[model samples]
Target chain A: MSPWAWVLAAYGCAALLVGGYVWRLWCRYRHVSRVRLGEADG
Target chain B: MRPFAVGATAALLSVGLFLALWVSPPDSYQGEYVRILYVHVPAALAAYGAAAVACGASALYLWRRDLRWDFVGRAGAELAALFSGLTLLTGMLWGKPVWGVWWAWDARLVTTAVLFLLYVGCLLVRDLADDPERGRRLSAAVAVLAFLDVPVVHYSVVWFRTLHQGPSISLQGVKLAPEFLLPLAVNTLAYLALLGVLLAERARLASLEVER
Candidate 1:
């Protein structure tokens, strides 16, 4: 692969990982909020 | 926290970047690409600073069990990861033209990689624990220990065999040409300012979350 390709791949992977992390955090936060609301209502 | 501090940093960073990139002359040897030094070195410094903040905050949290310290420590860890990753990426880009290789398993690079992973583990461990307080204390201890590796990464050349070169700006008793040094200083300050702003915002949001 070309040098630029390598650089792009490295950056792409970093972006993907960070994006995945934010998504996971969002999901967990939503889940926790839902559980807390359920407990408050029940 | 103070508006003046943020304003001063922004002004300093803007002037610094201008001085480093535009005012500084290109290296006679490295040419245009050497300008990458302005970005690369500052990112590395910011990474170390962030990690140091994490270490200090961790220590405070451990000693006083303050939730404020814990939140700061968490912010530092995350910001440090961003800076460290950028440092490595820029370094690799700098290396390919100069070193003829994308990466070498040299001592400094290896130690930095380890440091990166260590903090990453710190973040994961904090997230995974069932007991929040226990997790905070344990992660704080790890953050402190992981930061100890920063010096090792910095001084690895003096301590071990490595293909990587030593300090670019600092020479025997002389510094690099003002042209080179100026932009580097600017970018460095810019990075520090950016890190501070991000950390303060993250900490504030975290505190608000806890209060709610």
Candidate 2:
């Protein structure tokens, strides 16, 4: 592969990992908060 | 996490990407592939910092028996896993082109991979335990022990022969050029900001688990 290809791959992987992590954190946080809210209401 | 922190992470990362890709000159030896150093080094160091946080927080939990400390410990461990995983992946991406192999059994590489697995096992020990209190305490202890590898990973290049190079930026001095160092510093700050925000968010989620 070309040097630029390697650089792009590295950066792209970093972006995906960081973005995917934030997404998962938001999902887990929202799910837990929703559960607590349901318990509080009920 | 707070809105201000969220904003800072985005802003810093955006600027970081701009500088790393554009402002930083290609290395004389490695050419464009050296760009990988920006992401790889920052994430690796951040992983080390995160593991240290895990170690410290877990020790506090053991001393005070506070779930709050456990929450932070969990956050630190999880982020340590994430950042270290990124470090390994980026390292491989850089390695394939440079080293002519995707993986190596070198000391630096092996030690870093071990650090990743140790934290991962530290996390698994928590969830796999039969009792909640036992799980918490066990994981905390695991985190403490897992941290012993961090220093070894940091010094692996210096301590043993390896395909990986020694530290470019160290207490002694920076070996990198000014142009390269500037983008690297910026990206490292961005990754650290992201780490702080994620740590707070994950810890809050752990707290909310208690509320429910």
Candidate 3:
């Protein structure tokens, strides 16, 4: 790959990694909130 | 996370990305590839900051014997590992074209890899322990030791002969032109904000786990 390709890949990977982490956090937050709400209802 | 914080991060990142890709002038020597510095350097700095926070939280946990501090420490460790992994991956990506090799055993690279591994171990140590309190204490200790690698990673280029370049921006002044530095600064701020959001979300998850 060219130098520009390498730079693009690097930034792409960084964005994907960070975006994935944020998605995971959001999912966990939703799950936990639901569980707590269920417990309170119970 | 608050909507305002999340919205602000997205906006800052969008602007930062535009600035990095389009507005920033190409390096005279490296040409367009110098754009990698905007992401790579900030990721490294954020990783170092995360490790320092982990170290401080671990110290607080040890001194106070509070589980809340342990939760904070674990959150910091997780984020540290994430950013450190980014730093290494981006560095290698940048290195491949410039150095003609994807991997190097230079002091800076090796020390950074060690820093990444140490935090990964910190997370595993918490999970592998038999008891929650025991795990917290062990992980706290691990977090403290793992942070010792942060300074080493930062200073490795200066302390030894290495293929990696020394710091470009420092407290003294930025070494890059304003066109380059502006985007880099904006991106750094965005990453810092993202780190805060992630840490808060992670801590909340930990709290939920404990409550359950």
Quote the chain B TM-score of every prediction: 0.84, 0.89, 0.87
- Among these predicted structures, which one has the highest lDDT? 2
Quick one: ranking by lDDT, best first? 2, 3, 1
Instruction: Point out the higher-scoring one by DockQ: 1 or 2.
Output: 2
Q: Please write out the lDDT profile of model 3 over residues B1-212, one tens digit for every residue.
A: 38998799889889888998889888776678778888887888888788888999999999999888888899999999999999899888876776667776555566668889999999998899999898899988999987875676657654554345554322134257777878989999988887887887788789887787
lDDT of each: 0.71, 0.85, 0.82
Candidate 1 on B1-212: residue-level lDDT in tens? 47887687778766865664467676776655566667667877888788999999999999998899998999899878877877777777766775667686555456567778888899898888888888898899899989986676657654555344553322133247766765776777777886787677567656756755
Kindly report the interface RMSD of candidate 3, rounded to 1 decimal. 1.4
The regions of model 1 sitting more than 4 angstroms off are A1-42, B1-13, B149-158, B162-175
lDDT of 2 by residue, B21-52 (tens): 88888887667877898999899888988999
Candidate 1 residue lDDT tens string, A1-42: 454454444435444544564465566556666766877899
Best candidate (score: TM-score): 2
Q: Which scores better on DockQ, 1 or 3? A: 3
Superposed model 3: Cα runs more than 4 Å off: B152-175
Superposed by TM-score, candidate 2 places the C-alpha of residue B134 at a distance from the truth, in angstroms, of 0.8
lDDT of 2 by residue, A1-42 (tens): 678888988998988998898888889888987887888899
